[model samples]
Target: MARAYNFAPGPAALPESVLKQAQADMLEWGDAGASIVEMSHRGPEFMAVATRAEADLRTLLAVPDEYAVLFLQGGATTQQALIALNFAAPGDTVDYVVSGHWGRTALRQLTPAVAVNVAASGEADGFRTIPARETWRLTPGAAYVHITANETIHGVEFRPAWGAPAPDTGDVPLFADFSSSIASEPIDISRYGLIYAGAQKNLGPVGLSVVVVRRDLLERAGQPRADIFNYASHLANDSMLNTPPTWNWYLAGLVFRWMLDQGGTSEFDRRSDEKAGLLYAAIDGSGGFYRNDVAHEVRSRMNVPFFLTDPALDADFLAGAREAGLIGLKGHRVLGGMRASIYNAMPVEGVRALVAYMQDFQQRRG
Candidate 1:
């Protein structure tokens, strides 16, 4: 059977070439007489893998020297509580931007510990729009201001506007949950104090969450830190404070190499823009047969959610898409419709195939 194009939000599609390389190296990696998964994290061979992965990622994103890239075990969800635990004391407040389901979920985990101030919210509008940065009610002396740069569930993105100076948050740092949009575009690493992303979406496989944090922020995380979740501990031991996920780390290294081969983040941004444009154009030209609710300015290039005018044909449409080798087009259960997650690994040809399928489906159904 032929492989279908996968569009799942997290644990999404990976490049075919990367998978082929992994397969070839699975039993014997670089003539080491052992698989990467069998090697100890502290060994010279594995250390080289870790080092090269970090170097490639740093070059790809232009990560500053002041920031430490931590290959952590926890998913992005773990960072929510960990961030609160590390930064905010029992009575300290943190500013959160409520964008969509993931952002709200992050707040829920943090609320049990810290005082959360909703700096800006698009909840009232059903998360169809992103609140302007000027409208955020940032708390004075807040621990940090957090935003989900792209909300996967809502298909909303917060792109930095050109020629705009950074927002004045006094001494409070900016932390972004860039899980869905990490390598999908080029981000100015200097502008954010902490950026965390689950590797499953655009970077690599699951079980690894990459955290790029300014060194100063780790030093400033008040004492009485949890042993496992402490950023300082991970930094002090070079992400090997405990046994790391060796296999995930190895695969992540491959993904970093793949991204570099594909022309880095700038190329990713261009490809994502082109893919999104094709799909969005299809929806717009559908003559009310398909509708996308996300506001124009903040539309996500990674996840595109749309609803069919005739809800009764939803199942048929999805079944037809699957039959045509365009899989994972069904939207989240909470938002009953269709979502096409075109991550960095998804080829432009895949998006074009999807668009053609949608057009053919719409015409036949109509």
Candidate 2:
């Protein structure tokens, strides 16, 4: 059978060209005559791969010289702990803008380690919109302000225009968990003190977290941090503190190159917005047949979550979708609805296929 349209949120779809290149290079990368998985992290072959991947990403994102991009083993959940550990001393107030599920998770990870001030929260709004920054109750001299750039589970995104630190947040540095949104669009990296993303979403396979920290923040991490868990340690060693995730790293490099070849981040921004509009229109056009409650201004261009008007048709919808070559549309268990995560690699055609499937399902079942 032909490849299906896959919308799994992470370990998400990758560019076909990148996968093809990996297939050809799997056994013999360059002249090394060894699979990237078999190569030494310290060896020259993988070093070149590591170097180029970071370079391409830097170029694609326009990451400044003042920042250090470290690819480490822990996913964003680990970075949640690392960010709090590295930034705040015990009992220091840390401000968090809770917008959705992941935002709450990041806040919880910091609770036992720091005095967390809920700067802003949208839970009362059902995770449908971001609380306006002006409304935030920021503590003076808070260690840092953290926000989730995109809430994958809730289908809400803190868009570029809304990504700045709260006005009263003062000189407190800003950090973002861009796990699902990184590389989906261009960003003003200068506004953020640090940014992190798990590679599985838009970058590549899992097992790697891309941590881009402003060089100055490296000094703030408290001592007594294990070398392996230390961002500074990873920065100093160029992310080779121990054996890295070799194959995933190499595959990510290919993905970065693919983005550059496809006209960099701006092009991606246009395509992402375009694809999301297509799917959202389908939901809206269905009248009461389907629904997505996320506010229009902050709806995620990367993940689209919707519910069938008749919940009874949920299983039948997914089953029919799979037969029609549309997969991974099941909603997160917490949300109890259907979600479509159209990451950077999901082509316009795949989204069109999904929209068509939705229209057909509604015609049959509505």
Candidate 3:
């Protein structure tokens, strides 16, 4: 019973070392007599845990002094409406460039409540490409411009580093959904007014979303933000305004430490490129046997989605993958193809193993 290479997106793979640490310390955490799961979020033990987790994350991302990192309870989806509430007033508009599924989800959730302006949309291209920056129709007097830094479902990514000097955001703040791309590489956090990422993807586990917001934006929150959904409140209370997701918070801390031990985000960036490069090279070299729909320029280095020439072989392909100790090759139901989510936790060995299995699968069933 060896471990299988997992390719599932988001509640995806975690570093094995982190899991083992959790396992070894499950029954007793330090001198606390109680496990992390059993500790009070308000107590010194868990508070120190929370504080270190935040500090380590700040170091890992090189977050600026002006930004407050709030470890929140809900996933990124919750941030959509909350962001709208916190940033855009009733009559003021919120602009978005809807590149994929989660971007559209944000659009839908923010509409009606706040005026929604789609600055650009890739839906016309079937979400296979990112709409170029020059073509965007930015709204005047908009609260902020939002972009999904990486579209996990569509395999499209706009690396924050790739778009420095700010991409003509036009005096408004730039807010990015970094859920799938967070910590995958070095980013200029100072360019963004806010960033929200679900911990499940590249961070650690589910149940907590890390939000980094500039101090000024917290001060300028749109009127009538509910207490729980308010950024200012969360920062004021130190993200423990109420009971936070204690265990998930603890596990995320383990992951942050692991990232530091592995040489921070730059190392992860290299590993991600190496891993995803192997997969995409395999797909591109298959001589039309395997094809990916994404445009070359904006193709995701994190989520690699490909389709086989003969759709009829998809099931056999997946079954073969599983037998070869590869798992979660099934594509999203809406997309109907294969997606290999090679996040920070997925090793070079896993991607290489996948490429090897893919070569065998293609030969047998091509």
Candidate 4:
């Protein structure tokens, strides 16, 4: 069967060329006579792969020298708890800007460790928009201010505005959960003290999460810890404290290389905007047949969720989309609509196809 244009949220889609290269090199990676997955994480061959992957990512994102990039596991969910464990002590307060389901989940993880002040929330608007920065009430002396840059389920993104003062936390650091938006745009690394994401969305497969933290934050973590959840330990050991996910790391390296060939993060930002524009245009031009709920300024460029005016047509629309070679158009159960996740691997052509299909579907159903 031919490859389908996949739009699943995470573990979503990868470049076909990368997949082909992996298949070709599965038996022996460069005369090593062993699959990359079979190699020891401490060995030299695998070390080279790990180093190159980190280097490529650093260059791609322009990560600064002050930041320590650690490839850890447990996905972004673990980081939700780990952030509280590492940064906020008992009785310390932290600020969380609630945008959507993921933000709520992240805050839920920290409830046992600290007082989480919801600085701002769009829940009153049904998670369709972001609260303006001016509306946030940040607590002074808080440990950190946390925000999910892009909420995958709600299709809302908080774009960093230039020339603005950082959020008021009174010596607190800024942390971002960039699981759905990493690599989709050029971010100001200096503005954030810590940034983490699960690699499944835009980087690699599951089982690996990337953590970018400033060196100063490591000092604040205090004492030596033995558990895998300890960020300081992972940083001290160069993210190989234990047996790492060798296969996922190898695949992530291929993705890094692919992104470089495709012109790095700036190019990615441009293409992402273009793809999103194409899809949003389809929804906007559909008259009353289709609608997107996200506020214009905060709409996600990676995940585009929309709904047919008639909710009863949801199943038929998804089935038709699949038959037309567009897979994973079904929205999350919580959202109960159609979501088209056009991540990094989704080509502009795929978006064009989806838009054309949307037009056809609208005309037929009208």
Among the numbered candidates, top TM-score falls to: 3
Candidate whose lDDT is highest: 3
Model 3 C-alpha RMSD vs. true structure (Å) is: 1.4
Report the Cα lDDT for residue 30, model 2: 76
Clashes of each: 0, 0, 0, 0
Off by over 4 Å in 2: 163-168, 221-223
As for TM-score, the candidate ahead, 2 or 4, is: 2
Task: Evaluate model 2: give its lDDT.
Answer: 0.88
What lDDT score is found at residue 345 in candidate 1?
A: 94
lDDT accuracy of residue 97 in candidate 3: 90
Window of ten residues with lowest summed lDDT in model 1? 159-168
Global lDDT for candidate 4? 0.87
- What TM-score quantifies how close candidate 4 is to the native fold? 0.96
Could you tell me the lDDT of residue 364 within candidate 3?
82
lDDT of 3: 0.89
Better of 3 and 4 by TM-score: 3
lDDT tens digits, residues 1-366, model 4?
Answer: 888899999978989999999999899988998988888899999999999999999998889999999998779998888888887777888899999999999987875557779999999999998888789998988888998888999999876452122344446789989998899888878888899999999998888999999888876652233467688888889898888888999899999999999999889999998999999999988897999989887889989899999999998998999899999888998998999999999999999989989999988987
In the range 72-180, model 1's lDDT, one tens digit per residue, is 9979998877887877777788999888999999888874557789998999999999788789999989889898888899998885552111344667898889899
lDDT of each: 0.87, 0.88, 0.89, 0.87
Q: Which clashing pairs does model 1 show? A: none
